[model samples]
Target: MKWMEKVEHMYDQFTVREQKILVTMVLVVVGFVFFMFAFFISDAFDERRERIRVLRETVTLLQKNRNLVQESRQAQASLELKAVQKPPMLQGHLDQIAKQYELSLNFTPQKPKDLGENQEYQVESVELKLHDAPIKNLMQFLDQIERGNYIMMITDIKLTTRRGQPDRMDPVLIVSSYYKRSAEELKALHDKAAEADKGKDKADMKESTKTTKDDL
Candidate 1:
């Protein structure tokens, strides 16, 4: 009430037009302050939301790494992986599985390639054609592949009804498998790295000697 009295006293000092102009100016200033506060709050919320999203994705990635990650050397010790002759070996394995499942199977394997120097395993893929297959049978086959000692991923699949036989389905499968680098390849990479390190050391020694001569 005392504040209101002060406000009224101040208001009485101005003419009608002046009072309206003063009120307009006050309203404009108050609106500007509120707008600025809302803008800052919205920006803070966006930043916090993005940070939370990144943290959640990081947690998920860590969980995945914990479950399945293996060093290439360790994988080599446990599993029989033929990086050089991958196609014949993979085809034989798949043929055995196909016969057991009583499904007609055909496979075409792509050339295996190095993922990267830091990556533990190289990538290889197989394209499969399954004729007159059922979903239940296909699920069983996929389950066996994943549960086995080998690390394999079914990257893609396409299914369609067999022509003239609507009851039967044809399925195409793309399977990606990981394997350790061959011993020869690993040795080559190691030698390359050793040469680089030697070169770097020589450069450092030369630079240091130059710096010492300059100081003298």
Candidate 2:
């Protein structure tokens, strides 16, 4: 009680100017505390808002990627369906290629042996015994083999001078070129080829059917 009374007496003894100064100081301190709290809350909200913004952006990007993936899958499915409808025509195409390349196939075509469930063609050497030919023909033959559809490999080569030809040191080249199918590689190549041909045939059949139906 005595302390309270002394405090009241001291407050009463202060001049009006001192009293105004004391009130102002208390108000300023209270205002400072309020400002500090407001600043702290504002900073916290700002951080949370920034984090939300980043998460939203990440989600949007992921959604875009998902859409792109779906589109790619759809495109691939359509292409596969088309391929499945066509028929295989690689042999005819190979013949046409041979004609276009002007390559004369000296070897007889043989039925490729089925190496059991392996549909991939295997290349076996076709040996040839030839007298030497001119350098130009030899090079052309090699070039044709390189550019041909079937893999042609030269297994053996012998160079000899032409009989009755003088200065025969630059002898004519006799090459044994072997033509064979590609090595048996299980890469679904045969399946894909078959599917592509099937797709082409289906597409043609559908067109023909459409034409007949229209005529009717």
Candidate 3:
């Protein structure tokens, strides 16, 4: 207490400019120390918060992907159990389709030329030499083609009546269509599927044999 009182007395006796300089120096040093401590603590907290936020976001993304992965696995399991037969006998299917429509027409399937990657190619075109028939038949034929199993589209059309000969009016319809590797690819995929089926069959046989031996 006595030392503090003597220091206060000495501080009061100093000149105004000296007191101001001493006060300013002490304030500057204190402000610098506070600024450094605040900056360090703030940076550390911000870094920890950022790490927590990133971890939370990562967990959310993983959970979302987990559902997708589960769905894909289920789909794979179903596909492995049951699969469709492919390269569906085009000629027979086409004949059946034509018969179903009762359309007197010719189907000229061309040899499929390989189109380069991601390029489109024309598949088959049905040239209909229409007889003197009602427009209803034509509409039905077009509708059947449009709604058929394979992808088919109507492209080029030409309608012409005879110049001189009456009672013989026929329209020439040349329709272009596009085909993809969906069916052929499906067929090729079956090669691998066949191997998988054989493996499954063996596994099933082994299980059945083991069950029979246990029963015995």
Candidate 4:
């Protein structure tokens, strides 16, 4: 209270113009302080908003990664379920299906090939030629093969119409079956091949040594 009364007493001593100038300066300083405070508050809010936006983006990315992982796991599970532990006898299976449809099939077994970069699976395929087969029977045969217990697919099919019999078709089919080999099985195969190679090398060395003894 005493300071306020003293500031009033000092203000009363100044001329009217000076008093007006002093009041204007005080108002400007107050306005500048308020503007600086408001600017800092606005900047703080903007920074917080930016942080929240970044956090939301991160959360969305994590959710997408989780979904991808789940999808991959599901696909792997489906593959494991469908893949057979042992290769199915593709020729016998095809013959069985053809019998069910009452269609005669000429079977030609294809060379089996290892699948995947790691050779963890093998594909066994068979080529079949059906002569003078009815279209309905052919369709049924194909359906049966596709719906069989083993993981089999009709990789290729070629149908040619008979010259005189419009209802009969000559169909050539290539069926492939997939089977998974366990790590132990693959290791055993590799070991067996290595042993064979070693045996061959030893035989060759002995033959060379015998020739050298004869020359001496």
* lDDT ranking, best first: 4, 1, 3, 2
Report the C-alpha lDDT of model 4 over 82-198, residue by residue, as the tens digit: 885454588877888789888998989899898887777888888999999999988888988877445788999899999989999999989999988788878987798899999
Please write out the lDDT profile of model 1 over residues 1-216, one tens digit for every residue: 999999999999899999999999999999999999999999999999999999999999978886456565567655654433333256666777777777778888888766765543678788999988876777778766654555666889898987887666888988777766677777887789899999999999999999999999
lDDT of each: 0.78, 0.56, 0.64, 0.88
lDDT of the structure predicted as candidate 1: 0.78
lDDT measured at residue 214 in model 4 versus the true structure, 0 to 100: 100
Candidate maximizing lDDT: 4
Which 10 consecutive positions of candidate 4 have the poorest summed lDDT?
79-88
lDDT of 2 by residue, 94-200 (tens): 33434554433333233334333654334333333334344564455556543433333454555566668633313222222222224443456576778999999
lDDT of 2: 0.56
Candidate 2: where is the Cα deviation over 4 Å? 1-6, 69-216
lDDT of 3 by residue, 67-146 (tens): 89899999776543332212244445444655665655555544544353533332545555656634556566666655
Q: How many clashing pairs does model 4 include?
A: 0
Model 4 TM: 0.62
**Model 3: what TM-score?**
0.34
Candidate 1 Cα misplacement greater than 4 A, ranges: 1-88, 163-167, 182-185, 189-216
Top candidate (TM-score): 4
